[model samples]
Target chain A: MTIEEESGYRGKAEEFLQVFKKGAEFTQDLLRENERLRYRVLELENSLNSATAGSGPDSQSQALIQRISELEQEKKAILDRIQQIEDENQDFANRYVEIEAENNNLANLYIASYQLHSTLDFKEVLQIIMEIVINLIGAEEFALMLLDEKSGDLQAVACEGLDRDEVPPVKLGSGLIGQTLQSGESYFTDDLESYQRDILNPMVCVPLKIKDHVIGVLSIYKLLLQKDQFAQVDYELFTLLAGHAATAIFGARLYSDSERRLSTIQGFLDLLTK
Target chain B: MADYNILIVEDSPTMRQLISFALKRIRGVRIVEASDGVDGLKKISAEKFDMIFTDINMPVMDGLKLISLVRDEPNHKGVPIVVITTEGAQEDRQRALALGANDYITKPIQPNKILDVAKQLLKLA
Candidate 1:
C-alpha cells in the first residue's frame, strides 16, 4: 500500500480502538452503578426490617404504659373514694360528739329537776337552783331573791360567792335585779359598772314570773375581763336555766305552805277531841 | 405396617375434641389423644406412634417440650412432629424446627389442611 493509504487505515484502527475503549468504560460504569443500586436496595430492606423490629418493642411498651396509666387512674379514683369516706366519717364523728354533749346536759338537767321534787325547803331548792344555773351557764356566781309583793321590797333568798351583808336589801324599782322584777322581763348587761355604781363586770337579771306575776328574780354575774367572751348564746342559756329555777322554787314554796296548813288543821282537830 | 400412627397433643378442650373428630374421619389412620406434653410422653411410651401433631401452648407441658422429649426417644429418632399454634413468627418457626419439629401449622386449624399435611408427611398421595 501507499504511505498515505496506510496512514489513513492506521487512523481508522485507532478510532475503532478508542470507541471500544469508551464502550468498555461505559459498561464498567453501568456495572458499578448496578452494584451500587443493589447495595442500596439491600440496605433499605435491612433498615425497614430493623425499623419494624424496633417498632415492635416501642408499641409493646406504649401499650404497657397505657395499661399502667389506666391502672393508676383507677388507683386515684379509689384513693378519692377513700378520702370521701374519711370525710364522711369525720362528719359523723363531729355530729356524735355534739349529740353526746347535748345528752349529758339533758341528763344533768333531769337530775336537778328530780332533786327539786324531793325538797320542800326553800334553802334546799335555792341551793339546787344555784348549782343548776352555774353548771348550765358555766357562770362564776348566781343569786336568787324574792320580792315582798305587799311591801314592794326585794329580799335575797339565795346568794352564791357573795356576802349577804354586802348585797343591799333592794326595792322593786331600785336596783338591776329590782328593775328586772318591776319590768317582769329578762335583762342582760355586759358591764354592770355601765348600769350600776356598786356592781362591776357583766351581769344577767331574769325576772321569775308565774302566771304574769313577777314573784322573784335570778341574777348571774361574771367578771368581764374579756367582754367579748359573753355572747348571746350565754344569755339564752342563762334565761333557760333561770326559767327552770323559777318553776322549781315556786313549786317547793307551794308544797311547804300546803304542809303547814295540813299540820295546823291536825293540831286543831287534836285539841277539839281533847 | 401402617404409614403412621399420629398422636394429637393439645390442652384446649375444644381444639382437642375437634382434632380427634377430624382424625377419625381419615381412613387407615391410627390416632391417639393427649391433653398435654406429659400425657403425650406417657402415650408415646406406651405405644409406637409414627407422627405427633401437637399444639405449642398447653397446660401441663408445651409442644416444644414434647418435641424435644420425643426427639430424644430411641424409637422416635427420625419420626416427623408437627407443631400447630396461633404463632406465625419466623423466629417461632425457626425455633420449632430447631427443636426437631418437622413442620408448623398456624391455627384456625382447617381439617382439610391438617389432613393434607398428614398425607404429605406420611407420603400417602
Candidate 2:
C-alpha cells in the first residue's frame, strides 16, 4: 500500500522476467550446439561404414591375387611338361629316321642278292655274286673258291679287284677260307697278320652249303677297315648270300649237263641217219 | 557183315593216295581210286560201291556232275556220297548238301576226321 513498496515490487518482477529470457536464449544456443554435434557424429559413423566396405573389397582382391599366383604356378608346371614331351618326341623321331635308313639299305642288299641268284650260268652267277658282295659290303676285293667234291681241294673260280696271277688254289683244310669250308661255318678275321701273311687286311669268310654239305667258300677282303667292322649280322648276311650263290651254281651245273646230253643225243641221231 | 566198297574221285595223285591210305585203315572197307571224275564215273558204272568219297575240283569232270549222273542211275540212287574238298564257303556246303551229297568234309584232310565222318554217315558207329 505504499507507492515506494509497489515500485520495488515492480522492479523485482522486471528483473525476474529478464533472467527468464536469458535462460531461454541460453537453452536455445545449447540445443543448436547439441544438434551440430549429433550431425558430426553421424558423419563420422558414415565415414567408418564406407571405410569398412572398402576393406571388404581389399580382402576379396587379396584372395584373387592368391588364386592368380596359384594359377601361374600351375601354368608354369604345365609348360614344363609340354616342353619335356616335345623333347622326347624329337628324340624318337631322330631314332626312327636312323632305323628307316638302315632298313632301306638292308632291303636294297637283299634285292640285289636275289637278282644274282636267278642266273643259270655258272660263270655268270659267280661273277654276279662277287659283284653283289663287293657293292653291298663296300669291299674292294672278293673271291669265291669252290671245293672239289672228289679231291677236297678249293679252287678259286671268281675274283674281283685282284691281280690275275695273285690268286692261288689251296686245299680245303689249308688256309682260313679253306678251314671255313671244311667246318661248314663262317669265319671273320679283323687282324689278318694273326692268321697268315697272305691276308692283307680285315676279311670275312662264309661257307657255301647245299643240304648240310659244304660246297665252297666265299671270302671278302675289306680295304678300309674300322672298329666293330665285322659283326654277327654281317656273317649271317654273307652266309645267306653264299647259300643262294651255291644254289645258282648247282642249277647252272644241272642245266649245262642237260644241254650236253641233248647235244650228244642229236649227234648220235645224225650219225645213225648217215 | 558185307565188305563195303568205297569209290574215291580226285584229280591230284597225292590226294588220291592219301584218301586210299585212310580208307584202307578201316576194317571191312575196300577203296578203289580214280584220278578224274570221268574215270570215277566209269568205275562207278562197272562196280556196285557202298559209298563214295569225292573231291569238288577235278580235271575231266567235276564232282557235282558225277553226283548228278550217279543220282539219275537207278542202282546208284540213295548211295551215300561224301564230298571231301578244300572248299569251306557256306554257299559251297549248302549247294553240295542240296545235290544229294550225304556229308561234306574240308581239307587238309586228317585221317581220323575222315574216318569219323565216314562211320557216322554209313551208320557204322
lDDT of 2 by residue, A21-80 (tens): 999999999999999999999999999998887777779899999999999999999999
Q: How far in Å is the alpha carbon of A195 misplaced in model 2?
A: 8.8
After superposition, candidate 1 runs with Cα above 4 Å error: A1-55, A134-142, A191-202, A222-237, B1-125
Off by over 4 Å in 2: A1-61, A192-202, A222-236, A269-274, B1-125
Residue-wise C-alpha lDDT for candidate 1, range A164-240, written one tens digit per residue: 56566678677777788778878776555554434422167878777567778877665322233543445554555
Error of 1 at A209 (Å): 2.7
B22-107, model 2: which lDDT tens digit per residue? 57657889888987889999999898988998887678898888888889888889999998654334566576778899997765
Name the docking class for model 1.
Answer: incorrect
Residue pairs with colliding backbones in model 1 are none
